[model samples]
Target: MMMEIYKRTVVGEDGPTVVTESVPGLRSVSLGLWVRVGARDEVSEQQGISHFVEHAVFKGTTSRDAFDIANSLESLGGNLDAFTSRDVTCYHGRCLAEHLDIALAVLADLLQNPMFDPAELTKERRVILEEIQSVEDTPEDLIHDLFAQSVWGRDPVGAPILGTPDTVNAFTQDDLFEFTGRHYRPSNMIISAAGHLDHASVVEQVEKLFGSVPASPPARRAPSSAPRSYQHYYRDIGQTHLCLGTTSWSYIHPRQYDLLVANTVLGGGMTSRLFQEIREKRGLAYSVYSYVETLEDTGLFSTYMACDRCRLKDAVEVMWTQLLVLKECGITEVELASAKAQLKGELILGAESMSNRMSNLAYDEMYLQRYLSMDDTLKEIESVTLEGVYDACQTLHDEQGMHQVTVGP
Candidate 1:
């Protein structure tokens, strides 16, 4: 059965707020405030400021202290959360449908009226420093950061999303305030809601809450990238973790869906070639997968695995061999059919959630500037062909375009 995904958008005086049509008799609603600014917007001097702002906003707002802010949501048996990434920072929550107005008001207040208390800033700075140290201690997670550094070099886009301890230590309240003023404008943000939402009611509430926020475009810059290279870091550890990667087109590219399917065939699922060949056949490693993350202007295609130090070389060899095989012989019809179906199934399953739907709305408004209907997305996934996926592999598998990062003793 083809399910219809109805979406409505209201361009209030503040900015655009989009609401996905509600599911009949759904239990919860997900509300999100998405700002199109993130770590990538920071310069070397301002690194980590965006992430700090993400944490700080939750600390308190003008009317609600951090405790009040938290209790307000929890009392309703709802959830509150926020995260900062390379390109965007989001504050999102889910609650009973009847409490949607309260959730919306709280999120709007946090965005427009954060207190940025000095004491809270100091506490968050210490917390972030500890976080940086924690990352240094976790090799499985650290390898991906190292891989990004290798691929992007010194570009801010390639820098760690959590920022360095030094950078975190250097940020000030003024810096955070300036960053917020610069990027947290109406024109640079989107409000998305899904699940059991009354579109007209939500729109009316959003206009009243946000109608006064000034709208302005953000200053933009491009990231600098270097050619792919091999980077090895020696650390005394029981297992070696590596991130093997290559460059690929950004989200707007025509071949993105093809790349998505190709990535799945390579190592995405437990039944994938990497999992089958590495674990089932050779018993090299317990964990292995390939993933593709496409941004507005760039993308990363990476395969990650962890294994005993003794098997590192063999594992790398096997992983590289899989890439080469896909480039030369391409995926078989069975693999092609399987990958497409898996991708489509996953897409459908995610549609069952209002949180995922709201997140999708934010992503579309921030990058694509046009809403992509779920039907369109499914069609695109189905439209991918074996030849298209093969060509995508051939284009991305170039030796000159591949980068490898290894961390272990």
Candidate 2:
């Protein structure tokens, strides 16, 4: 049976925007409390405060200890987690539809009243420092951070989310309280939920929990400058990890789908040209893929591959060759049709998850300022013609603006 999905939005005059999608016949609900501040909004001294707060909140809250918070949802056979990104941070939970109250209560406590004990902060700082070391030891993961530094240069958007050891070590309990007090106000919050739920019920609970929290003005973000053309890091690793990319359109732009389709044809899946040529044919690398990330004001289109040091040149040559081919000569009608089908299938399947729907609600509210139904998104994908793909390829693969980062011996 086809489930009837209904979406609604409500904003207070002094706001923590609330949006909900009610999917009838579902047994569970996924909810998230989103904050607008992230790495991009931080100054150099507080590079990872946003992410630090994400971990710190889990340590304990005023009403609950760390163990209680950890077991809050799991005791009900559900899940709870959070993440900080370049633009926002989210603390979310999922549980049976009837237990929605528990999920909401636990998340609200974490958001409104993290204890951030000095002893806890000290322990978390060491844990985060260990995390930094973990990333440094993994070349494949570390290279992406280096790649961002290479691409955005000094832009705050390019700063690592985990932060450097110095900045993280300097963070105190007061720093967290200050950062959260500034960014966790009503104006910076969005409460989103999906699956079996009632919009008014959720809103009423949210208002009761958060009504007294005062609003604040939004933060100003600096524009990103032009990306550098190339960068290389020499590591003693046995294989070369290469990430090559260029700027692309923002998520809100009408042309975003064009870049999506272009990416699918290049290295999105096993059938993609880079995967077929570089891995299947030449056996240069076991993993090679292309990805696109569209931010609020800008985006990134990048390809990554890991290969034997000696084969790095051949692998890069093939990667660029495929990119140029797609740019100079657009994909065939059959290719376009196949890519469209792939995208539609993934979209439809992903929408079935309450978590994905909950996330889509917040993302659209934050970035697009409007919601797009599944039909709307699918139509946009279908509308991408060969000419559109060609234009996307040409625009995204511009050699002058391209950035390259390779980490290997």
Candidate 3:
């Protein structure tokens, strides 16, 4: 099906940005109110305020109680949800085309009228404390956070999204309001929607709901540089969790697609070299894969594996062999073609979801400040040469730049 994407600024340079993707035959629409403030924007003391605000907003808005907020969209066979990431927070919902106005209204109300009641704040504190404990109890999940911290030290990029227990416990109603007031300005927001929707109506409703919000200049905090390091934690778990990672380029780096191609060849799928070498060929691990994560300004390229403690050494050696081979010899034309096909296929398949499309619009705007159509992305993937992939591999495995984090007894 053909789709149309429209981009607009609600007022001017300091106003909220809006992008809508109109799909011809979809019955539902997905909408997101994206604030460019996230865990990465916090200082040492305010570590988890961004995530705290995300949860507190649902406790009660000025017009809707928690129960009412919960049912606002579910009553119409739709759903509302929100998430906090390192770089952004999004409150989003999906509803039938006929209920677009209601969805937008509920989102705007949550942002505009959150009460941040002291009582609700107290209840949420306990929930989030328990949530932090849950992560501590899960070794596989905790290792990534540890790895990130090891890589970036105390920088906001490496800090846990859920924040530490001490930090979360100290968050008061005032803290949420303070952070929200500073970062939730219209200029730092993006409204993106996909599926059956009209650009004009969405823009008009958004302007009425948000146009009056005062603008604030974006606050930029330069990231502190940190060196690579190794860490190991002893746990009573049966299997060892290993994460070997190195730094990479930012989201908008010219060689971003090359990195993607190299990452795919490393651990992207069942056909990927790491999966095949570590799991299928040697039975060293049951779960082995590589991933490329690019934030707004920096990125990480990591390969993760969970295996029997006894097999951890073998798995690490084999993973290293794969990396060295990729760096030294690069990928064959056949492997390159297969990786490109895999990426293009996934990109196309992902576009089948309206939520993905909605997110793509926001992400592209956030990172590139422009829309990158699927065709453009496919062409970029197609343009990655074997030499480019080699350079990407070499960049990722820089000597003295690699870091390792392991968790297991």
Model 1 lDDT tens row, 181-275:
87877656778888876788887887778754666655656555568698889989888888988766788887799999898989888899999
Residue pairs with backbone atoms closer than 3 Å in model 3 (clashes): none
Every model's TM-score? 0.96, 0.97, 0.97
Provide the lowest-lDDT 10-residue window in model 1.
Answer: 1-10
Lowest lDDT 10-mer window, candidate 2?
Answer: 1-10
Query: lDDT for every model?
Result: 0.84, 0.87, 0.88
Candidate 3 CA-lDDT value: 0.88
Instruction: Write down the TM-score for model 1.
Output: 0.96
Query: lDDT at 402 for candidate 1?
Result: 84
Candidate 3 error regions (>4 Å): 12-14, 221-225
Q: Which 10-residue window in model 3 sums to the lowest lDDT?
A: 217-226
Candidate 1 deviant stretches above 4 angstroms: 1-5, 212-215, 221-224
Expressed as tens digits, the lDDT of each residue in 326-368 for candidate 3 is 8898888998999999999999999999999999999999889
Which sequence of candidate numbers ranks them by TM-score, best first?
Answer: 3, 2, 1
Off by over 4 Å in 2: 212-217
